[model samples]
Target chain A: MRIGELARRSGVSVRALRYYEEQSLLDADRTPGGQRDYPDGAVDRVQLIQQLYAAGLSSRTIVELLPCVSTGTATQSMFDRLLTERDRIGVRMDELAQAKAKLDRVIEQVLAAGLTRDGATGSAPVGS
Target chain B: MRIGELARRSGVSVRALRYYEEQSLLDADRTPGGQRDYPDGAVDRVQLIQQLYAAGLSSRTIVELLPCVSTGTATQSMFDRLLTERDRIGVRMDELAQAKAKLDRVIEQVLAAGLTRDGATGSAPVGS
Candidate 1:
């Protein structure tokens, strides 16, 4: 497949596909006339790269780990790094959860005070 | 207290406090000596500002919503904007969760393939 086909199928832009190749995260073969041709597996590989990016892994780190993910026979260092990123994602999720909870509390506090400002502090009963 | 004291109490840097003030997310009175003097409540306000920042609200959005959180009597539009930010945070959390799950699946696939490469594919029994 061509770059456009891969981009269309994988939901990534052509410029991003070119960037992945530049970063050595994706591979394509150049034809005799200088056109790039990609294999069918490039689709899944691009998706995998997208997932790692979404998980906040940098392109350098992704390049390092792509081989392990592609072949599954990498050294312990790569495996450890992958676990570290997974833990980082967990930490981020925890932070987001805390932020959400804080927002919830702020909303609650604002509404409570708003009620007071509206003279409904002591007038309304529960569920009334 | 002065800006440094507020920074210590709030666990935010003096530079960031200044940035918050510049963004109108915080306030301080000037002393005769040209120092920034903050009220005791400034500590809590700084913390609230940090929480909103962690929730991924931009300075612009934070400035727009701070009045409602501060006075509890903002217009309905402001309240609705706050709700919009809350919902955006929720959406971001969901995206992070999905990304994490994808990472987990990739980790599992790598480990499974690593086992196969180690010649343990069909020979290993559970707990053996």
Candidate 2:
């Protein structure tokens, strides 16, 4: 497929796909006309790349991990580095979960306060 | 406390503190000598700001939410906006969690493959 089709299928922008190629996280073949051509599996590859990025892995780390993911032949050091990256992502997930809980608490308090004020004044709740 | 003390206490850098002020996410009073002086609550305020930022709220949204957070006098629009921001954070948290889980699965597969390869060769696991 072309870059546009890949972008649409992967739900990633063309610029980001180009960036992934620049980062060595992705690749594309050139046609006779010198246009980029992606394999059918490019969609899944791009989705995996997006997942790794969302997990907060840098492009460098993603580049390192992608080959190992495909071949399952990582060296000792590569395995250790990938484990460390996984741990970092775990830590980030915990932090984000905590932050979300805090936001939930604040939102509950604000809404409860609004409800109380509305009850006292016998008016519809704000934003209702 | 001065800006330096506030930054130290809040575990934020001086440059970030200055940026917070620039974004109106934080404020400091000017001393007679023109140094920035922060109130005792500034530390807590800065921590809250960091939490909101971690939750992916923009500086503009944080600025709008701060007053209501402190005073509990938000209008209907402000309340709705804040709720929307909170929901956005929730959605982001879900996405990050899914991404983390995907990473976990990949890591497990990689590690398990390494262990099997090591067993077959009767060698210590790679990176062990």
Candidate 3:
């Protein structure tokens, strides 16, 4: 498939696909006319890349992990590093959960305050 | 205190402090020598800005939300927007959790394989 089709199928932008190629996270073959041609498996590859990126892995780390993921021949050091990264993600998730709780508290306060103001002024409730 | 002191107290870099000022997420008074001087409250304000940023709010949204956080005077639209942003963070948290789980599974498989390899080849266990 062409880059456009890959982007559409992968739900990633063409520019991002190009960037993945630049980062060596994805590969494409050149056609006789010098246009980029992707294999059928490119869609799944792109999705996996997106998943790793969403996991907060840097391009360098993703590049290292991709080969190991496919081959299952990673060195001990790679596994150790991956474990560290996983722990970091765990910490980030906890922080995000805390932040979300804080936001919920603030949202509750705002809604409660709005309700009181509306009651006092006889105004219609917000978003009504 | 000066910008340097604010940065030190906030544990944010000086360049980032200037960036917050540029983004209008922070403010500073100027000394006669034109150095940026921050009030005592600036530490708390910078911490708040950091919290909002960690919640994945953009600088623009932070600017909109800060006044409400401090003064409790947000409009209904702003409140609605904040709720939406909070929900977005919730979704992101779920995604990160799933990603972490996936990483955990892969890490387990890698470790199991390494153990098998060590047993077969009489190699020392990885990281031992």
Among incorrect, acceptable, medium and high, the docking class of model 2 is acceptable
The worst-scoring run of ten residues by lDDT in candidate 3 chain A lies at A115-124
TM per prediction: 0.78, 0.85, 0.82
Rank list by lDDT = 3, 2, 1
Which residue pairs show collisions in model 1? none
lDDT of 3 by residue, B7-105 (tens): 899999999999999999888889899999889999999988888788778999889878657755456677777788889888888888887887788
Instruction: State the lDDT of candidate 1 residue by residue for B1-128, as single tens digits.
Output: 98888889999999999999898888789999889989899988988888778777899998987876766544556667878888998887787788777667767876665533233335232232
Best prediction by DockQ: 2
Candidate with better DockQ, 2 vs 3: 2
DockQ of 3: 0.38
| Docking quality (DockQ) for each candidate | 0.35, 0.39, 0.38
Residue-level lDDT of model 3, residues A1-128, one tens digit each, is: 99999999999999999999999999999999998999999999999899888878899998977765765545656777778888988888887887778778778777766632322434334554
Score candidate 2 by DockQ.
0.39
Instruction: Supply candidate 2's per-residue lDDT for B76.
Output: 66
Window of ten residues with lowest summed lDDT in model 2 chain A:
A115-124
